[model samples]
Target: MGKRFENKVVVITGAGGVLCNAFAAAFAEEGAKVALLDINEEAVMQNARMLTEKGCTAKGYKADVLDQESLKQTRERVNADLGTCDILINGAGGNNKRATTDNEFHDFDLPEDTKTFFDLDKSGFEFVFNLNFLGTVIPTQVFAADMMGKKGANIINISSMNAFTPLTKIPAYSGAKAAVSNLTQWLAVYFSKTGIRCNAIAPGFLVSNQNRALLFDADGKPTARTEKILRNTPMGRFGEADELLGGLFFLADEQQSSFVNGVILPIDGGFSAYSGV
Candidate 1:
């Protein structure tokens, strides 16, 4: 049997990260020529090399999602090497510590010595917003051009569960991902006639290098917050990176989901559906 993405071209940003890397490998295994883009030149190249070793057509590009010039150049190179991008995975976004507060809420009964909202740094807020929001927009602007009028062309933006219900400390990431979700809908309508579908995947709490410290303790055990997450999640555990692959393949394959657009599919193991009842 032929692969689902046989002879297709797919671009994944932040392709070096664990989750995106899983997406890249999954797509490549199905015969897609993968363009792995990441700000970390070494990491992306390493990922590309690993894919190539597996007899997959893959290439790595060093492009900062926040830099329009770099993104345009990278897009041009990708087009020249692989065909016009048919599928784009906007996976290059994360939260910074600066925009996150140490505590969930402000303590009113403190002796004038508690860290509060006033402690939030301006640069931190800007960094988180730009990284998560603009990081997505800039890449979409550069790559979606290749998808215009192309059959089976689609774009998947990566959102977070916090986008639907704001988490405790990371306000900026929540808002930015919410904007991403909203943008996904807007673009779906904006490009309805162009044969390009726009949608988003809101992942629930998943353990990664970015959030391992927050989710696990020094002893490699689940933290209090992690416990809370599992308790609220109907699945009763964190998601594995491979769990997202099925939804990704469905969205990327127009034959499977031709009518699906402007939707945010929460691959959170029912975390979004549960109300902690």
Candidate 2:
């Protein structure tokens, strides 16, 4: 059988991460001309090279989504090299250490020596907010410009489980992803007349470099948080990267999801629906 995205032009941000890297490679294998964008030039290039070696049309570009000029330049290069972008995957987002609290609660009566909510760094909060929120906005502005009025144009934002319900200790990441979900709805309405569809995927727990330590111990045993996550998830395990590709390809192909817009699909193995019993 033929691939769903054959001969399409697809752009993915944060292409160096495990999830987005999987996205990039999968799209390439399906015969899409993949543009892998990431701040880590070497990592993005390596992934692109691997795809090319397997006879896929793939290219890597180092650009920060926070920088509009860099994203604009990347958009230009992608258009010149791979034709206009029909699919955009906004995958460039993560939590920073500063934005996280040492613990979930604040003891007002506790002494100042303890790390509490009062001890949370403002700079850390801002960093996560900007990276997760502005990162999505700027890239959408820059790349979606190439998709205006084009056939099969779609934008897929990478939201998180925190968007639906705030997670502990990571206020900034949670709130920012919430905003991403809101923006997805807003853009879908805004672009409805222009033939562009905007949607998002809210991924649940997945073991990646960003949270490997938090989810597992040095001996590779599941941590308390990981166990809690599994207990709360109806499927009882972390999701695999490839599991998201079906939703991705569905949103990317207009014929498959032509009327779907403003939807935030949760690829969370039932985590979003389950409650701990």
Candidate 3:
């Protein structure tokens, strides 16, 4: 196939993170002008530098997904630098330690240090929820404006497998991702008339910088949760970040998926299908 995204302007939030950085590189390789947006200025800039070194058109922008003004400003810069946006990947969302409970289930007379759902910090819960949910919304509101009434315009939200089935001890992340999935459907319907397809990919357990510690111990042994995840997954292994690119490419390519919309595609290792029976 020729360059699928030649001259196309693809913008991705959370591009500083491992998964989204890979997405940026893939888009750049496909001849798209990739704009990497992240709050971590240094990280995104380094990623952009690496891609540019490889002769790809890419630039990094320091953007806060929760801040509409910041995104709007970044949108102007992206528009001026690389033309209008053809595809937007809402890849900015994550969990926080404060929002996550210490134990799977609450028990009476638990240790004071043990954080139950009731003990969850309100600020942390709001931060996590807003980051995943509002983070998707604010950016779309700003960037999708350029896509209005334009053919081949689309939005891809990064949801989590927990969105389909809530995981224990991380209620905030699960709930936020679930909301993102729902918003994807809502956006699809809302933008159908405008020719902007909206969809989401709910990733399974992936070992990335953000979750590496959770998956592995200092001794490099699999953690308890990692073992449980593998046991539940039919594929019996965690997914690689690059493994998600195909689904994203399919969704972003208008000709390939013209009729695909409001779909929450799961890139899990059949984890959603298993029942532990």
Best by lDDT: 3
Q: Write the per-residue lDDT of candidate 2 for residues 1-277, one digit (tens) a residue.
A: 7887888999999998888999999999988999999999999999999999999999999989899998888999999999888899999999987777766667657655666656678998888889889999999999888788988999999999999999987888999999999999999999999999999999999999999988999999998888889999998889999899898888888888999999999999998897665
Clashing pairs in 2: none
Pairs that clash in candidate 3 = none
Query: Model 3, 186-216: lDDT tens per residue?
Result: 9999999999999999999899877888889
* Candidate 3 residue spans exceeding 4 A from truth: none
Each model's lDDT: 0.92, 0.91, 0.94
For candidate 1, the per-residue lDDT at 59 reads 98
Clashing pairs in 1: none
Error of model 2, residue 224, in angstroms: 1.2
TM-score rank, highest first?
A: 3, 1, 2
Candidate 2 error regions (>4 Å)? 108-114
103-147, model 1: which lDDT tens digit per residue? 777786755655557888889889988988899899999999878
Better of 2 and 3 by lDDT: 3
TM-score of each: 0.97, 0.96, 0.98
